[model samples]
Target chain A: DVKVTQSSRYLVKRTGEKVFLECVQDMDHENMFWYRQDPGLGLRLIYFSYDVKMKEKGDIPEGYSVSREKKERFSLILESASTNQTSMYLCASSRPLAGAASSSNEKLFFGSGTQLSVL
Target chain B: AQKVTQAQTEISVVEKEDVTLDCVYGTRDTTYYLFWYKQPPSGELVFLIRRNSFDEQNEISGRYSWNFQKSTSSFNFTITASQVVDSAVYFCALRNTGGFKTIFGAGTRLFVKA
Candidate 1:
């Protein structure tokens, strides 16, 4: 079974602090994603990386950035944490699909998630 | 813009009762994927099922089932003989063909009381 490991299960940080959330996947998946889950907003994509040193901005990437220096590790960085940045952060990885004809079985494997609280 | 809507915010039912969660999506792409994920108290989103655009067949696995209706743009999930362990927040998601980003709905929280 594929395993996605998150560095922290619960994190607390004060405003203006720099926060780093690390995630590693054992499966050699080509795609990695970061999402923040809120009460009513569901899961909003923060950033995604398809390859080493390559990242793409998701729907909500204003105060967040990502770094993927190696194939197994992906990191999400909060430049300066604020109260609004407090949320449950989830990391997921998946294998790349070819195209429309690709099988639907290619699903995402998620980590246990890091619940970050900004004070 | 692709969007997924899970209209049912929350549902509570006694054990052994059946419950259905509704999902509706909007997308212009001819080929897309729909998915249902379960987020238990552990906070990890577990992939439940995934269906592509061309397949409209309803599927049943154990006590869980999914109904896919392309004409209505809906993919609903049902759990028969619910148990306390089945309580969780269910999310419906949509991803266009070859797209990297997946859009998720607000989610429906199901509570099964013993």
Candidate 2:
């Protein structure tokens, strides 16, 4: 079984506060991702990391950033939290499939998620 | 860029009834991957199935089955004799071979009534 641990299950922050959501995975997955889930909107990718210290912006990367200091840990940073930014945050990691194209086997193992509320 | 669209916003089914969730995707890459995920009220995503571009075979697992059509670019999920436990918001997703970008549909919320 793979475990993707999130730092907090629920968090409340004031508007304009900088927020950090941490994620760690026991599996040695080469790919890590951050997503924000909202009602009707589904899940939107915020950022992802394929290796330590490497990060790529997803579709909705505006006003958000990420850091992957260690292979097992990836962090999503909200530079200035706003009411619109409050949503359920998800973290996922996946081990690349051997003998195939890297993204061909994207069976993602996901964290429990962090529900952030910016008032 | 890859995009996924789940047209049905919500579906309600009585116990023992079968329901199908539709997913349509748009992508230029010939070798992309499609996926279905179930998000329960607990707010965690459960990976259901993954299909690559080359595999067009329909798959069945217990009461859950998936229909992947390359021509329509549609990956639909069906639940047979759905139970109350199967109620959740289902999402359709797409990821290309290049990685970095995994797009998701708006999701269809399912409610199974007993």
Candidate 3:
């Protein structure tokens, strides 16, 4: 079975503090993503990386940044955490779909998630 | 623009009852994918099903089923004989064939009472 491990299950940080949420997938997937979940907004993508050192901004990337220094590790960084940035953060990984014949079948395997609370 | 709407915010049902979760989507791309994900109290999003735009077949897996209709731009999920373990927040999502981003709906919380 594929395992996507998140560094922390629960975290609490003060406002203006720098925070890091780490994720590592054992499946060697080429695609990794960061998403934040809120009450009424659902899961909004913050950033994604298709390859090491490559990143793409998602729909809600304004308050977040991501780093993919290694193939298996993707980290979401909050430069200055704020109260509004508090939410459940999820990390997911998937096989590359660009050249696949049936790309629609490519689904993501997610980590347990990190519940971050900024006070 | 691509969007997914799950209008039913929450639903409650007794055990053995049936329930349906509604989903509506809007997108400009001719080729797209629709998905259903279940998030229980564990907080991990589990992929339930994925359907392409061309396929309108209604699928059933055990007591869980999905209905996809391109003409109505809706992909609905139904649970037959609801159980207490079926309680979760279900999200409907959409992704274009050429893009990497998958937009998700607000989600529907289902509670099954024993």
Which predicted model would earn the best TM-score? 3
DockQ of 2: 0.69
Ranking by lDDT: 1, 3, 2
**Best candidate according to lDDT:** 1
Fnat of the models, one by one? 0.61, 0.71, 0.57
Candidate 2: misplaced stretches above 4 Å? none
Q: How accurate is candidate 1 locally (lDDT)?
A: 0.93
lDDT of 2 by residue, A13-115 (tens): 9999999999999999889999999888888988988899999888899999999989999999999999999899999988777866665566888899999
lDDT of 1 by residue, B54-94 (tens): 99999999999999999999999999999999999999999
Tell me the DockQ of each model, to 2 decimals.
0.60, 0.69, 0.62
Report the poorest 10 consecutive residues by lDDT, candidate 3 chain B.
Answer: B95-104
Question: Could you tell me which 10 consecutive residues in candidate 1 chain B have the lowest summed lDDT?
Answer: B94-103
Each prediction's number of clashing residue pairs: 0, 0, 0
TM-score of 1: 0.96
C-alpha RMSD over true interface residues, each candidate: 2.6, 1.6, 2.1
Model 1 Cα displacement at A87 (Å)? Answer: 0.5
Worst 10 residues of 3 chain A by lDDT: A96-105
Kindly report, for each predicted structure in the order presented, the TM-score of its chain A compared with the true chain A: 0.93, 0.96, 0.94
The list of candidate 1 runs beyond 4 A from truth reads A98-105
